[model samples]
Target: MNIGFDGKRAANNLTGLGNYSRSLIAQLAGFFPQNRYFVYTPKIKNHPQINRFLSIPNILTELPNVPGLFWRTSGIKKQLLKDNIDLFHGLSHEIPLGIHKSGIPSVVTIHDLIFLKFPQYFGRIDRFIYNLKFRYACKNSNRIVAISEQTKNDIIEHFNIDPEKIEVIYQSCDDSFKIASTDQLKESVRLKYQLPEKYILNVGTIETRKNLLTLVKALKQINEDHVLVVVGRKTKYADLVNQEIDKLNLRPRIIFLQDIPFNELPSIYQMAAVFVYPSVYEGFGIPVIEALYAHVPVVAATGSCLEEAGGKYSSYVSPFDHNGFAKAINHILDHPKVQKEMIEKGKDYVQRFNTEIISKEMMGLYTDVLKLHRSQHSNDAQLSTRPQRSRRSQRTSKN
Candidate 1:
């Protein structure tokens, strides 16, 4: 199979969709080496991280012969045909226009409908454009891959897509997260990041939807000495969160980290006393899985797909419930037995998202779509080749 992907995110964005794109391609190449893979990007940067993917034997990187916008809109179809792509997968929410007309089966992965779900967070014009592209992609693609069941249900509810047309495939954390960090490694990371001896960790973009202010409020209720360490890119929301911290006089207890090297993340997760995710919504909470993989007990907000990501063993509280969040955090910290049980269960549940398992499931979907496409083409060919007969002869034969 000559498989191609819209590698814009994989080549540019370093987190979320980029991680998903890079991991998917790498896993497929590692496990299914027989198939050739093509990654289409408008431009390639000098980043060493993304450049390493080019070394894979059966993998090739393709660039546009024309301008970048032209490539993304319509020129990509020509490249797909030129490369003899058997299948195209849009790693993000969209596929190129006219891809279906080019006689290629395509799959689009819709991460979430956050803009539609929370309209106030996005601009009207941006939401309108996003709605147009997403709806068109969902309607045109041969199949849809939702990162979580919650996302899959959202697609069905928001768009008039068939439930059977969508498949739920969970994403996994980096392989480094699965490995246990050594005591020495943890200590080094602790010193490097100036991490406290015990702290509650939250990892994600510092945005309004992440609900960091609520988490900060929860800290005021807790009587323990656990500091709050936030790790992610800071947006304008950070200023609001900071003001809230100042208003509560909790500045001494809160720490914000950004631009930390990727390799040190596992140690940070392993070293944390507890991992708290208080987001109001998510496509799929990858950090919950990452914390679980590190054997760290998780306490996440209730609502949306977080329950699915955190699993049943992990504790959950309402996103807006400051007392609930505080109580859950204290309970996990105080009870050694409960923490042990949560960690054990989390370890087992996270195996379902191992690269081997997820890769196999994705490969199966690709195979099914390819088989269906071939069968339909064969039927069309047979019908076209059949000799035509007069209307009366056809009616007599039928009678």
Candidate 2:
């Protein structure tokens, strides 16, 4: 089978969707060597347009210069047809409009329905366009892959998609995230960034969705003598977060380690006394799994999918409850027994997201969709090819 992937997000630098796309694509190539996989991305600066998988003979990468042109009018459909793609998987949830018109089975991974769940968090035009495309994808997609059970439920409740149409394929973390010695990279990162020795880490973009302001406020409330280190790119909310920290006089305690190397991330996670993620929303909390694999204690928000991700392993607090967040942190800091228990449970929990399992389930989904499509097509062809009764046989047939 020939499979086409919409890999627009593969160009993004160290974001959640980018991580998901790269990891899933690499594993898909590894698991399904018999099938040909083609990844398509619009040309942009620094997009890794090369296929580095020398071992995977069937995987290929194609980058077309489609950034400035309108996607709908770019003759993309004609190109896809020329490739003879049997299945098209829109990993980014933006399937080219009218893809199903080509009579190819298309599946989309709707990682989350957050834009609909939290409309106030998005800009007006973005909200409008996202909802429109999302609805189209939901209606036209043959199989909708949700990253979590919570996300599947959200799709059903908000978009009213049939439950049978949705598949819950949990996201997996990279193998590099496990506990490792950071002694070499630690000095380099600390010296370059002027980072302190001990800190609580939070990894994600500095956005309103991350709820970092609440974490900052709770940081002030905690009496523990530890720095709060955040690893992510700069964003609009970083300025507001800085202002909030200034007002709270936490300049000495809060540090932003921007754009740390991915190789050294496990080292950072290993060194953390704890990793606190107070995100207001997440489709599948990847950081939680990474921290779990690294044996770091986790404190997260109770209001969203982290509950499902964290399971019994991590401490949770309502996103709005500053005091509760502080207390939870203190509880972990004060109790070694609780920390040990959490570490064990977290390790056990993350086993569910092993890369091999995720890849195998995805392959199963693709096979199932392909079989279903062929069965439907065969039935339709048989119905159309049925012989019509002759006009002269009307009297004989009646007799």
Candidate 3:
């Protein structure tokens, strides 16, 4: 089977979507090398993640014939047909327009409906365009993959897609987070970042929806002397967060670590006493999983798919409840027994998202989609070939 993937994220993005695309593609090749996989990206970024993706066996990367805004949206359909793509998978929220018209079965992974769910954070024009493409893909694709049950529910409610048409597949972080950092590695990373000796960690974009201010407020409530370490790129939201931090007189207790190399992330995770994620909403909270794999006790926000990612042992609190978050973090920090339980149980829970299991599930979905397409085609052929009674015979019989 020749499988084609929309690889724009895999080739360019270094964050959430990029990691998902690269990890899934690499795992599929590892498990199912008998099939050929082609990655199509409009532009490629020279990054280590892309290099790792390119290194995978039984995979080929292609670029668009000519550059245009709609290359991935509509122009790629003709190229997919030319490649004899048996199936196409959109790694992000959409697939090429009219792909079904080219006689190619397709699957699209809708990671979230965040723009629709939280419209205030997005521009009107951007929201309109996103809604158009997402609705189309949900209706046209042979199957839809949602990263979590929450996201799957969102798709059905927002797009009115059949519940059975959407499949909820869990996503995992990079396997690197699972490895324990050596004493030497930990020392190097700590010194390099000038990280706090003891801190509560939060990793994600410092954006409004991420709710970093709440975490800072929680920090002020904590009785312990530990500081807070934030690791992510800052958007304009950082300015508001900074203002709040200053107003609360918590600047001395906060450390913002920027542009830290990806290779050192696991060590940073290992050094933290506890991980706190206070995002108000998420399709799936991946940083929570990374913390779990790092064997750190987690206290994350409620009202989203985080529980699914963090599992039963990780503590949960309302995103707005700074006091509640503080209590949860302090509990993990103060109680060694509780921390042990969370660490051990979290390790067991996150195994459900390991690469081998995800690879098998992904391939199973592809096979099921092709089977459904072939079954429908067979029925259509039967209808087209079925003999019909002549008009004269019908009239004579009626008389």
What is the lDDT of every predicted structure here? 0.91, 0.82, 0.91
TM-score order, best first, reads 1, 3, 2
Runs off by more than 4 Å, candidate 1: 392-399
Ten-residue stretch with the least lDDT total in model 1: 45-54
- Model 3 over residues 111-199: C-alpha lDDT tens digits? 99999999999999999999999999999999999999999999989889999999998887888888998999999988887887888
Q: TM-score of every model?
A: 0.97, 0.92, 0.97
Candidate 2 regions with alpha-carbon error over 4 angstroms: 44-57, 65-68, 72-74, 390-396
lDDT of 2 by residue, 62-107 (tens): 6663444655323466667878998988886667788877788888
What is candidate 1's local distance difference test score?
0.91
Candidate 1 per-residue lDDT, tens place, 1-399, comes to 999999988888778898889889999999999999999999776676677766778889888867665688689998899899999999899999988888899999999999989999999999998998899899999999999999999999999789999999999877889998889988999998789998999999999999988899999987558999999999999999999999999999988999877778999999888999999999999999999999999999988899999899999999999899999999988888998999999999888889999999999999999999889989999999999899999999999
The Cα error of candidate 2 at residue 252, in Å, is 0.4
